[model samples]
Target: MMIRIRSRDGLERVSVDNPAATVAELKFAIESQLRVPVHAQILSTNQNLLLAKAPGDLNKFTDMLDPNARVSALGISHGSIVFLAYEGERTVAGPAFHPSGSFGKKMTMDDLIAKQMRITRQENPHCELVSFDRDAANAFQHYVNESLAFAVKRGGFMYGTVSEEGKVEVDFIYEPPQQGTEDNLILLRDPEEEKFVEAIALGLQMRKVGFIFTQTISQDKKDYTMSNAEVLQAVELHAEGDLKEWVTAVVKLEVNEDGGADVHFEAFQMSDMCVRLFKEGWFETEVKGEIDPKLSRMKKDVVVGGKDVTSVDNDFFLVVVKIFDHQGPLATTFPVENRRIPVSPGALRSHLDRSRNLPFVKRISDFHLLLFLSKYLDVNSDVPALSGCVRAQATVPEGYQLLIESMASAC
Candidate 1:
């Protein structure tokens, strides 16, 4: 008989009969499954994100002498609301709403794991999200070596399996990937797309901008109105090649503070907005933006000769310009910042290699930055090398400027 374990994503059955299996063993197993490392996990019963914890007893942390670890609330109904238990902060059981704000809906598998990430900060320390998927009960049995490979490379393993009860959960040692390894988070930016999403959000914000997200824009003002057709038109136009005048100016959104974040956009500014988005890494970001004054007119991306071309606009909504111009004048390089695992230099070199620009580094900014950097540095760094001098800092390199957490770190 195997020892049954419940994790954040689900539950699992470990084969080790000895309840005294080291925490290190459990961590290793968790790491292999979840892709988190052994060191980044904590043993806290609190649920706080963006904060650090006092270190645990290394021996206790590394050893799994206590077989019955309260890792998670697996084997339960999967719901949109997460029941978060906090110790130092709230010290009570409260509802944790899903980031998407959809209540009582089943999240995608990715969202399900991401949900744990928030709770992982405080409630569940021994958990992580990995890049692979397998039969809930047999991921470990199938990908043990692969899990170890990720453990050695990107970070630690983040794997999990379901219990005999069939709940969706994950288990892993919360090893944070190495800091500053893969750091470049992307954003989504298509004038039409942005307009549609923004319009929907605006509708939500004012009870006047509403097509999706269920949150209605609180404003009942007749001055503001949005419809799916008008929104779709702008997107269609962008997909075609009609509007292309780029306006790269910083539109301030507020005052009483000297910060540069009060940014908003209109359809006329969509071209530059799109550029800003591309620079920010919204290669394939889902369409999101308020409805243009004329959304029904927007077009979808035009594909000619098997290539894609898009138009830009401004009337879509407000485009708050952040970084007008910088010295490097490069677009974003790394899409998101990722942490690495603990491994000697050579053990995971191959894993790191995959992240490198394949087939001569695409991304218009990389091309320009490499050229720009080369003009100041060397030529060889242009093609298959990471120029030591030039870094394609994103226009919005950090996550969201207006928001507390910008995708910048993740980007």
Candidate 2:
């Protein structure tokens, strides 16, 4: 039997030869196969506890205490996913330095000091301000507010362009496949979905400009606006885009003193210094247990006021620039990925019947609807054919339109 294991390092699979293996035996298998020390490993089926641990409680689950308890009896079976949290660091036996490597021929005290120097504040942002297209912002917020109800986290990529005055105008959003929870967001990207997004961007003359996410209302009670893990995740995404004008936007429900929930939006761009530190491996990547508020602090200047910040003085954010609003092309009438939309069998049939007069690509303007249609469409022919319509912004052929509409109506 194979079990999937997820940790901070990412997902892995481990084989448990014996169906009747005990919990202790499973621990040993993980230690041997995954290189995590048995004593240091804290395994659980609950993913929330994998990252967010309560104060003073080291081991939350008592299942592993009984070494002789069979894993199957404990409800762990083949193909199940388990979460692993470990203490201390795994020691790797390796040479101290490779003589031919970059760090091997180390030099003077000046060189060492240069590497250890702290990242300082920058004076300006590459993006002056990030302006969310009103429709796009409303579309994203509507999903989080109406569907998710501020319970779990949800995230997506911003697609648009930066203006001459350094304002980033986000025209649309493309949410990659992901798993969201109160404390974590794991992106599971689909290549086909990405191709579709690229086609949309190509048609609109936009690019992947920024990232946006929703913070659960539970976080409003916490001290920091963004947790260390959240900061790390946002920075990692920002770094991946490799765009100077990249923005990181967060939407959360803030409780006013009167106990009413107000939807709040904040935006920031990772400072050049912050990006450099991340690229150079200066920021700590391994975050576990309770996050220290100071861990996310850095001396970086941002554009909101453009002052040299010594630390994160406010709960707003560490790298806040500012926010603006605009109007975009897409309508917020249809549902998006990761958002729940109440669709009835009757409504679907009605929509299909109504769309009979229009082309297939135009019939389903929503990406989520397209995703639903993709399951029934042939991957080699129908999928790429429809995707081409998006890429070229061309009219959908009548045959393809009829097929997709029929499939959608049937569903």
Candidate 3:
């Protein structure tokens, strides 16, 4: 279809190829063809609003759009879009008026608490598989209460999708361990790791919460290690079929009676060496030594030992991602620029994208992300504290943050 619109100044024509293309794509196409930044871009769809000045925050400006990540091909949920007006107070470059004659919904405190893009709502094909689990509401967000300093978890164990009632639904969902399917486990990479880390940081600061997860898939529970060193060498462990299932043994840790912790690790005795090497960070240590590269290489050989594994083989563990009760809070007052109705800063939006807007708004318009945390798990535990930017905005250095500890955490 060819589209031609006569503006007050002149005539404009555009050709459509993929009707399936979303408003986001159309806007991008127009921007690309016209060589204009989305900030000043004018788009008339269901309703109109200025495109937000932030990248990674697409939902705000194109809530009704189809989020198709061609590069990664991950389509975004349409309801995730939000209308963005360039200025914190208003949009001055909107020549196209919205049919609804309004600027869409205004963001609220609850929205901030939910860390939702008020402008965007999840689209209709909302995956009916997602049923509500009232039992775990916001339970997964509790991890944000950790001391507001730099912290990262291997993975998140808890979180729920945005609920229809506008509340966040948290849950401890489980999936059977893959007997031997590599595709069954979608392992995350560094960018995804950073994405979670950023969300964790913001959730702790703004929502007083985030998540930690360990899918059985995320762990390698293949019993590769053995209590007997001789067994590891004598028994060649290989699956019989072209699709071999490597069963890696795994273990959990507990705080022992003597105040020291007893880490009961599972796996072949050969792997014991590596697990021991992993201990320094989780405890309170400032510095760490690098493991000899030779050690890692040698260990891989010992495990594979010519095991005819398939083309795809990675670690998987069906551990839990849990959000503990927060011992902190999100900042109520961080600075925000009111230059326009939505004067979103690029840095701030980038952070939200990095965090996937995890049910908390730590920094809005270069503002702060805030959440409420009890220094203890509850009032019975202790006074509620705050984390992230709240601590940063405190006496701590601008680039640094103070800390807070939760009474109950890392479950």
Specify the highest-lDDT model's number.
Answer: 2
**Per-residue lDDT for 100-179 in model 1, tens only?**
44433334544433333210011211112111122211222222223332122121112223223322122211122232
lDDT of 2 by residue, 316-372 (tens): 334677888976654444456644444444554655566668655566655445545
> Positional deviation of 72 in candidate 2, in angstroms?
76
- The C-alpha lDDT values of all candidates are 0.27, 0.68, 0.27
State candidate 1's TM-score.
Answer: 0.16
Give the number of the best model, judged by TM-score: 2
TM-score of model 3 (CA atoms): 0.18
Candidate 2 — what's its lDDT?
A: 0.68
Count of residue pairs whose backbone atoms collide, per candidate: 117, 0, 75
Every candidate's CA RMSD: 27.7, 22.2, 27.2
| Candidate 3 residue 378 C-alpha distance from true site, Å | 35
Q: Rank the candidate models, highest lDDT first.
A: 2, 3, 1
TM-score preference between candidates 1 and 2, better one: 2
